[model samples]
Target chain A: MSTVIDARDLTKEYKSTLALDAANFQIESGRIVGLIGPNGAGKTTALKAILGLTDFEGELSVLGMDPRHHRDRLMREVCFIADVAVLPRWMRVSEAIDFVEAVHPRFNRARCEHFLARTKLTPSQKVKQMSKGMIVQLHLALVMAIDARLLVLDEPTLGLDILYRKQFYQTLLEDYFDENKTIIVTTHQVEEIEHILTDLMFIRDGQIVLNTNMDDMGERFVELMTSAEHADAARALGPLDERHVFGKCVFLFDGVSREQLEPLGELRRPSVSDLFVATMKGTYE
Target chain B: MKTFSWLIKREFWEHRGSFFWAPVITACVMLALNLMGIITGEVFLRGHPSVMVDGTHLDMIGHYLTAEQLRQVGAGLDMSMLSVTGVLSTIMAIVVFFYCLGALYDDRRDRSILFWKSLPISDRDTVLSKVISATVLVPVITIVVGILAGLSMLVMVAITATFHGANLWTMLWTAPHPFQMIAHLLAMIPLIFLWALPTIGWLLLCSAAARSKPFLWALAVPVGAGIIVSWFSLMGVFNLSSTWFWQHIVARMLLSVFPGGWMAYDPSIFQHTESPMALYDSLSLGHMYASLVQPEFWVGAIAGIAMITLAIFMRGHRDDS
Candidate 1:
């Protein structure tokens, strides 16, 4: 796969806080990568840097162009849902469609209208008159219509209810995603997007801690549930984390072979939520 | 070229109420008031051998005047037709001021700047759209509305004169005053744009930079400077003059957005207008073109261009907002 974004020593500082501290990562086209992190962990900062909405010191390239200098040109091939409530309250739905069509050469007006028609939003409806869910629907309709090579979504479904969140991802996957495009998303509701993500990244304190594709992750990480007798043995084997559930013990291991882990007890692939909890165990403190 | 036009259209869409409907409504109100005044005057002069039939303005005053005096009356009549514009332009000044104060700040306040930035449009284009809206679109709409109102009033007078058995209808079609007024107002647009840029640039800078209350910031800077200048001059701290600061700096920063606001500083306009007819004769396109060459005008215009450039940079770099 060709690289979509490549950054080496990407850094950003806001006064006393180093929001992104020499972070480095490479993303390939045709992958849905989830950049997961806790609050204030530089996920949004990194997205801003990539979008050229913020300045930083480092070498960064998106779609083979430096976003810092070519933001307007870069935007021709890149689309983003920066925030759901960001659509101006004074704008009408038709005006929003018309503006994007006028300014964005890649925008497909018919496609936007098709998506908008599925919703209850009318052409004359103003953004302020819509509910939070309806706003995201409108935003998604707008972004999905653009034939962009890259799509960045920062907390795209932040305040939405479960139904809206599930529907958002479903629509994105079915209508917007393609092998020709790359998607980078960050959200606190990691579990909702877990199943759709092809790759995972865990960041903390402006540093990327984990970067691996889903298949590599499955091969490198395993969780084992053992009886009381096997708990010590599991710990002796140096599992990354160990915990007790009822009278039984569960141990999570990183890069420990499945063949070696199988003889101890029942083994299953860990859920992304479990991995995230285990990985970010001490972040709050 | 197309993108620039769309960018301007976007601005018009957002501010049509103030930029368009405000002037239209003001002109309509002026016409209504003028119509009411004429009907009331007709009622009061009923059966009194009204001046309307007695060959009005000339017959009553012509017997007591010279040829030069009669020509002055004609100029006065020409000038009076455009008097309603003076009121509308004042209202236009307030509308444009508040619009500029909110132009950049409102998007940041509501976080819609993020949405706007998500498009391919650059900060330069976005800022230029607003600048053009304040300088060009506002003046054009207001001028058109003023002309429409003046024409309607002129027609009403012709009809009223005809009803009184006078052939003012022919005079109405023949009068060059309405066309002259339209040409004068149109010529003033470029002057308005040049003089208004300083205030528009100042307010836009405050709008893009102020965390809150841009109007207060825009106001406080110039007024505060004036106050400090006065206090310093009182103490003889420097060789500063307070009146010069208020007249040259503070007034231009606050009042330069008005149509012909630059002429307010020109003593010639008031000194010669001691006779009403001379006001029309003295204020011409040539007089306006002359104001363009003044050192003060170019200095203010250059400073405005600098502020506008700075505002563009600030809008792009202000990430916290």
Candidate 2:
């Protein structure tokens, strides 16, 4: 598959803090990659660098062009929903559709109308009149109509409830994603998106701590739950993280085959949240 | 070109209230007041039984007035039509002034710039859209509304004149030169644009760069400079007086956004004339374009372009939202 984004030594500074430090990564097409990170961990900053919303020192290529200089041109092929409620409050629904259709050459008006028809939004309704979930729905309808190659979503569902968040990702996967498209999302609710993501990236302190495909990650990391009797043996295997749960000891092992871990305790595949917790452990301290 | 037109249309959609309704409301109020005045005048004259508005009144006017006096009355009627439009222009000036002040800043303050930037439009195009809105679009809309309002007032006056036993169509309406007045109004738009350019550029710059309260920033900077300049002049520190600096820099940067604010351009446009037609010709496009010959216009135009360029750069680079 062709690479959609390639970055080398991408660094950004804001006065005294380093927002991105020598970050290097490559994302190929047709993948849903979750950029999971804690607050101020350079997740949004990295997304900004890719979107050409800020100035950065780096050798970065998005869709075969430097996003910093060709931002307007790149925007034709790349779509983003920068948080929620970014749509102008004064705009009516019809005006928003008219404007996007006018400027975006790839915007499919019929598809946009199809999406809006599923919601309660009318053409005369102003954005300010909609609830937060409705606003996100309108925004999604607008973005989904555009035939873009790469979509960068930064905390797209940050303040949403479980139902809205679930519907957001469901709509995204069912209606928007395709073999020719790529999506990069960053959100604090890792569990909600963990199941949909094909690739996972964990960032800490302006660095990528772990980057791997979900299948490989599942094969390499195992969560072994054990009683107190086998806790010593699990520890002897040098598990990456150890925790106590409901009078039982759980040890997370990396790169240990199932046969080796089966003899010590119950072996199960680790969830992305569990691995993310293991990777980001001690960051707050 | 299609994208640019849509961008302008987007601006209209966003500011429908200030652009369309504000002028419409102002015109309605002025028209209503004049209609009320005419009705009351009719009632009061009728109440005074001797003050009859029949053929006798026409005979009295023809009997008491000379041809020169009758001609002056015709000029007065024409002047009244022009004057109502003059009011509409004032409201237009105020609307354009505040609109420019908030053009670049409001989106940033509300965090809506992100949505605007997400589209394929360039920062240059976005800023140029604003330039077109403040210069061409708003003024054109106001001019159309002004002409409509002027015609309504003239119609009301003709109705009252007809009631007074005069053929207003031949005697009054013919003297007004409505088409000439309309052409003159349309022609003045370009002058308004040039004179307003400096102020538009300065306000938009503040709107882009100010972190908070762009209004305060736009106001304090020029007024503050004027105070310091005047203080220095009071101390006799410079060869030129403070008025020169205030008129050349401060007023150009602030008050030029007001309609027909090229007052510094030739006060002789308002000079007493032999007739209302002469007065109309004095403020014609020829007299207005004469200001273009002066270096001040070019100096302000160039400075305005520089500030606007900087504003565009700031809007592109500064990602505070």
Candidate 2 stretches greater than 4 Å from native: B46-71, B171-176, B234-238, B270-281
Over 4 Å off, model 1: B49-74, B234-240
Q: Output DockQ, candidate 1.
A: 0.81
Local accuracy of candidate 2 as per-residue lDDT tens digits, A61-168: 999989888888999999999899799999889999999999999999999999999999999999999998999999999999999999999899978788889999
Best by TM-score: 1
| Residue A69 in candidate 2, Cα distance off native in Å | 1.3
For model 2, residues B1-321, the per-residue Cα lDDT tens digits are 999999999989888998899888988998999888777868876644332221123323434566765655555555666677778778877777788788888998888888888899998889989988988888888888888888787677767766655555666446646666778778878877887889889998998899889889999999999999898675355577888888888889887877777755666777757856678567666887886777777888789889999999998888787
What is the C-alpha lDDT profile of model 1 across A156-191, one tens digit per residue? Answer: 998888888999999999998999999999998888
The deviation in Å at residue B57 for candidate 2 is: 11
TM-scores of the candidates, chain A only: 0.98, 0.98
Q: Chain A TM-score, candidate 2?
A: 0.98
User: Which ten contiguous residues of candidate 1 chain A have the minimum total lDDT?
Assistant: A268-277
